[model samples]
Target: MLTPQWLDALRARITLSAVVGRSVRLQKAGREFRACCPFHDEKSPSFYINDAKGFYHCFGCQAHGDAIRWLTDHQGLAFMDAVKELAAEAGMELPAPDPRAAKSAERRASLSDVTEAAQRWFEDNLSAPIGTNAREYLAKRGISDASARAFGFGFAPDQRQTLKAALPFDEALLAEAGMRIAPEDGGEPYDRFRGRLMLPIHDARGRVIAFGGRTLAKDAGGAKYLNSPDTPLFDKGRTLYNLHRAAPAARKAGRIVVVEGYMDVIALAQAGLAEAVAPMGTALTEHQLELLWRQADCPILCFDGDAAGQRAAMKAIERALPILKPGLSLGIVRLPAGLDPDDLVRERGAAALEALLSRPQPLAEALWEFERDAGPISTPEAKAGLKARLLDHVGTIGHPDIRALYRRELLERFSALAFPPRYARVFGREARRGEQARTSAPAVIDRLQQLAKGGARDGFGLAVLSGLARHPGEISRHEEALIHLARAEPALGPAIDALLALSETLDSPAPSPISGAIGLPALPDRNLYAFLIEGNSPDLVREDLAEAVSLLVEKPALKAAKAAATARFDRDPEGSMAEQGRLRAREMALDERIKRLGRKRAASPRDDSSRSPSPGAMTAQATD
Candidate 1:
């Protein structure tokens, strides 16, 4: 665990702008640097980096945090991954891991030793007299000795048990390193690879953790390429080859390209495209995609033009969709049929490969192309199928704004392609209904606000609405509770709906349209809502409003529990009594929380209003 002091020291050492500016284009904006928010879609810049404060905040998406948070959220790094990356950048050693983690760390260190020792063993075999065929294979592939050694290329001898004898490890250790196979009988373990060219797979820190081997022997029944199975230290699905080398170049180039195999990555590097990486033999996993996203927003995926390559690209697209965020997506490059990245570079030169990469297709466009060609769309059934496929892909995107836009773009193409204008006109009324719902949303909100003044329950419900209105940004934090409340009290449903709608557009600190929810009828005494809407310190009011909403949610939950406990009184007397006691204790705790919050409010200078919201405001609701 990183203590607060260590985190603070790390943050203080690393310039927030420097870290953020690598990925986002920042412009000077008075004291803070600004960029269009990476977390959401926006025309103008609303993401700000404050070097003075050592943090960044996206006013557009309400994504606010320090450097570590940026790494986790923006880079999709695991918490520890973010911390270690930052610590390394700041030149700080992490605090020692606790006992259990220390054990795991020691185990990994041992596994790494075995892999590294095996790497040396393979390199030795490469230059030995027996490695003549492997050297020939590299030469045939146009790989120079310099490039081969730079990538730590090696050869595994054809004889079995060769690695087992050379490496300083027992059979069990060798098997654990994925370097040896255990025989089914009560027999010895043998080397997994024979007559294969070897590539060392390194972790982000450039430590060898696994190996990928390709056949040097022709058409032997074995697979073309074999990777180390997942071991204590290596997971092919989570690992990317050449990342340790490509990351620095990727940061400089502001781009990263992902290819199908490690050979493709090495070929690109050899051809002067140093920013390419590839997943181990498996298709790109979410973990590997996150690794790619950390280096570039739109890494170009260069796949072969064959059926398998198209299938791989689509598979990657499906994997990427749900994790796609604004400003974070993929670009795709399809090599000509019967060609891969290596083939293209070899035949046409690096310039041709670069030219192909330059005009790569956007993921959305690729999606359209793939589905449009899935089948004939001349018939209505085929057209509907096309639309369904497009929507299915779009639905997988998790970000709200990005998802909406992808849907809009793809549906527009679908409408044009599948329906054309004549057929579109036939379904004009259906389309019109969608437009009407959108156009009428504001009127619905206005109507509901008017009705919010109709009854006592609504009056109280409107108080919750008003609180949310004053702190539009807090709507996201309390959205789940507000949604739950909507189900319980139908009177506040429309107001809750309006609050949510407004939250989506509350990208700026500009006056919220939903704040007009503060328009209240005259009451006998100024309640919490009245004071907060017109508070002197907007910050203070937002705090009080959050507490109020928490109470609003807790009240309904407590009532539901009480109802259940009372229902059980007849049959399960002792259980009901005990449950009732526990519920009462919880109610007392809730009362205390409200009192503490109210006291905090009371200590603050009051806004120019008739009264302040009571600290015990939740007590009345708890009993009722």
Candidate 2:
């Protein structure tokens, strides 16, 4: 026997991608790995491996499962064989079989028999002459005959001992299976469900584990929908209606539609959307969400357009926040006002329902909209309340990266709402100024002259830094190279650091009030280059600036190579000195290139496209 804890430990120790990749050729696809689904043939890669989530799914064929399931399905290994192989690979020992556990397992297996027997009996009753009202109710609800049979629709007669007398199973087994209600006062035990249109709820393996019933009588006094009690065979929280059927279709469709009830699921299925499921007459549980994620990355939650539906959506959002991962979240579809999925599909047809399903609101944006419209933000106090509520939701997120991103995105939305005019004015002017300055030779000259004056030895370095500070937006393109230069050459570290700092404050390469606040190196002696004068091409200056950064970035690497040569002299003196000479000459050649930068501006063709800095031409970065 293997305990669940030990199985989990074994699974935790195995990397799913490492196991899957042994047989499939995987390519890096963002946070997950993708490959052609080995289970089925396809041209484009639709299969994905997410090691973080520890599963593989094929959007094409709907083949999905964990490592153990993979071995069983793909390789045709038996359950324990797969488990034993995985455990051995994970360096885990199997647990010894326990008599109590075996007995409990046997009891659960026998209870399944009871549920299965009850399911057949109910189906027989629905087909019998006495089940006319249940059949009429199903037809009125637009449930087709095919759907009734496919979903195993049945009827429980309006009598206590109808099932008790029908099935040969003992009363204890019936009570244990939740098919019969045992009396607490030593009275006769009766059927749990009576006079209802019954639908069997299945486990993930498609076993009939429990029943959910809708009363057929017009004046029925109880709840409209009633579910079986928690029993050994079924835990409502862990079971989703139509999961076994929906899981496969969800994979093929690449999305799962979560409706409110099993009837809605059946209706959607009849309308050709077979990938729909529902919770067991309760708010979505964490276990149900996990099951949904196993079939699809982001299951679209389609709630009704009424108030209770919105509340259900909000509750689901709250439930999902703490467990959200990088690629796993929810998509919300708020149907047309005053309509549920079944209503929309029936009134507007399947196409209308499909349109809504096609365009789902992402969870984050939906969260923002839901909270923003929760109340009017007409006053400062009201706006502050909205902000507080949003932050409160954001705080509940567990993943650090996702939490920080949510905070940033939500706050940015908040800032836009609270102070839109100021940002618009500031960014609008910055854009206009940036356009004007890109071609303004005088403005370019003014920016160059702001840096500290330096001699010829420091002229090129100073020019590059000044040009970078002026085009502060491009700092990120060369951020890596700049950081490398800073680390390799300590003497230039302060000026480089200052320019990097300046780039952060300026939103664009425009003359910014904040840009003037950062310290900058003085201009090189103006006589160092004729290109520094007014009327010189700003375009050419930018090109030369990019080239200068590239040249200066190479210097440290050359120095490090020469030092490495020197370090090796004791062992390979001849080769080391020769290598050193080549490196030194390369350094001189680099120096000549630095001197030729200004001349390149003079002799270079005036191609407008070439003048614009290309990505690899300089490793300059963009704005944060």
Top of the candidates by TM-score: 2
lDDT against the true structure, each candidate: 0.76, 0.77
Write the residue-wise lDDT of candidate 1 on 1-624 in tens digits: 778898899989999998888878999999999998876668998889999998898887787999888766565456787888898998999998789998988877788889999899889888988888999999998899999999999999888978877888777778888888888896867789888999999877678999999997687898989899899888888888898788767755678898988888889999999989988877899989988988888989998888899989999999999999888999999889989999999999999999989988999999899999877778888888887888889878998557756765786576446432221234444222234333434543464557555765534445556555545555665555677888876766777787676555433343444323234333332243423434335555555665577676676678789889989999999999999999999889876876665465456555543243333221110000
Clashes of 2: 16
- Cα lDDT tens digits, model 2, 116-219, are 99899889999999899999988888888988999999999999888988889898999999998888999988999999999999876578999999998788
Residue 267: error of model 1 in Å? 1.3
Per-candidate TM-scores read 0.60, 0.62
Candidate 2 Cα misplacement greater than 4 A, ranges: 1-68, 71-96, 422-624
Q: Choose the strongest candidate by lDDT.
A: 2
